[model samples]
Target: MTHTPQKPIGSGFGPASTADEVIRGISLTGKTVVVTGGASGIGIETVRAFRSAGARVIVPARDTAKAKAALATMPDVIVEVMDLPEPTAIDRFASRVLSLTDKLDVLVNNAGVMAEPLTRDARGYEMQFAANHLGHFQLTCRLWPALVRAEGARVVALSSYGHRRAGIDFRDPHFERREYDRWVAYGRAKTANALFAVALDSIGRQWNVRAFAVHPGGIATPLACHMLPSEIEASQIFDAEGKPVIDPENNKKTPEQGAATSVWCATSPQLAGMGGVYCADCDIAIALPSDGSAEMHGVRPHAIDPISAGRLWQLSEQLTDATLD
Candidate 1:
């Protein structure tokens, strides 16, 4: 939280590491996990990986029909209707989940919107902030009892390199007075995600409920819906012939690979006593500066700042009307 870097531990895994590989020989038997956005992309792979290791997973989706259809074959995975940005539905969903389980081993706040056009929830809050940060914040707070009951629960927030795009503004967070830039909004939301984890860990570590933030790396997915074709081309994620290339030097990952960090954070014995850290490639990452170069990678100071994290926790509670404290 103070920008003290966490050295990489040589996890025997790297960006290309798959979820199965990360969890190989490990058992999640009898563990209970909830993964938002588990119906598709890396979330789907995350659900699959955890289930393969014998964990029971609950997937909350905005579209229950699509979720059910996508997850229909997985008898062990439960698909529930949950649109994160909506406060009332989130509350109802939390109530239902509590009624079903007394404890939770893992919570993956992985659902998020990328660079969409300006949009707000029913509360007139910005969509990315509300959904990516506040929704998970409220859900985690509401589920506090079960998390504590687990005695060693872990919460994973899906942050990103987008965090480097912008830190929390404190004021004008919703773009009410300022003009909106989708990337900046998204980056701030992601920064909030990481900060949320840092703050949660500081509060919950005493109860054995730790938190972590993960950068899943750049993967081609439907999450790219908002990216313009020219922007994508300029980014060089795809070659001129439309073939996908990961720029091996930069370490782009497959969905399974992207999911490895979340699973690792959730179940790795190596990380037993560590919490409130940002992770990537199945290991805790070092905090790096904003060089404004595409080749650079690491958590930013603001994203993991303790002061901002604490303030955000307070703000999140105020916004969502939910908190364990």
Candidate 2:
């Protein structure tokens, strides 16, 4: 299939559509979904909407207490401790999740660290890349059985506009020999997120398992904790009104709006047969320009290229020692 721009098909959804609005009539009774970083921000909103739609949502969190406190009022939501930075912890967490359920309808790889300083995980990989990409990579691989069992399982990888910074540095993903730049590291990780969907959809479609990469748009959330105040100020994300300017030109979106596309990709009947596509503003993205600037609509070709996807997949396997079993 050629990579063409996918229009809305008159789904009647827009950038302002809320998570609840996306699932207005979709009943998810008996559906099982696992959302990483579901304790706060857009993830929490996603959980609330899914649970409201009758799905049993499980949150794999690094801190169960924080997650439980945040989700105290929600029903059918369970919080389990699972640290993504620790590879061994991820293995155990996946095992526990498999033991609890035989089918997984959705897997939202929502948790991620932004442009943090140079640091390494327990496995000595870059912190941002490891936590955001490698962790989810292993989790999905380990849970492949359940996903296949569910039939038509959708895996949503939360990519970002930050992918414009750089594509995956396959030569040295760990940055062992190169100088570390936080934004570039984040860019690489987000790009990996998109390519992951492409590669996964290529392999998973036979089982009716589709994958999507989402640019959640720009949102003002705790995800900015790692950035300096000067950086935030220079970005001009805030206005004189002390609110984020919602100029589509800059691609800023509220958390509710940011979470909308993900929910749409997860439940929209419009995308029943589509997979391996990048989505933004509740619609399929077109091919992005090559300047690596965030001044356009659509995914970058390099980010979704099948060749790059395969290479990144192999690199991820080596870094995390995970196989799609």
Q: Best lDDT goes to which candidate? A: 1
Best-matching candidate per TM-score: 1
lDDT of 1 by residue, 52-96 (tens): 999989888889888888887787698778889887788788887
- In candidate 1, which residue ranges exceed 4 Å CA deviation? 1-5, 247-249, 289-295
Task: Report the error of model 2 at residue 150, Å.
Answer: 0.3
Q: Which window of ten consecutive residues has the lowest lDDT sum in model 2?
A: 1-10
lDDT of 2 by residue, 199-225 (tens): 998889888899999988777788988
Candidate 2 TM-score, C-alpha based: 0.95
Q: After TM-score superposition, what is the CA distance of residue 109 in candidate 1 from its true location, in Å? A: 0.4
Output the lDDT of residue 38, model 2: 89
Candidates in order: C-alpha RMSD to true structure? 2.0, 1.9
**What TM-score, computed on C-alpha atoms, does each candidate reach?**
0.95, 0.95
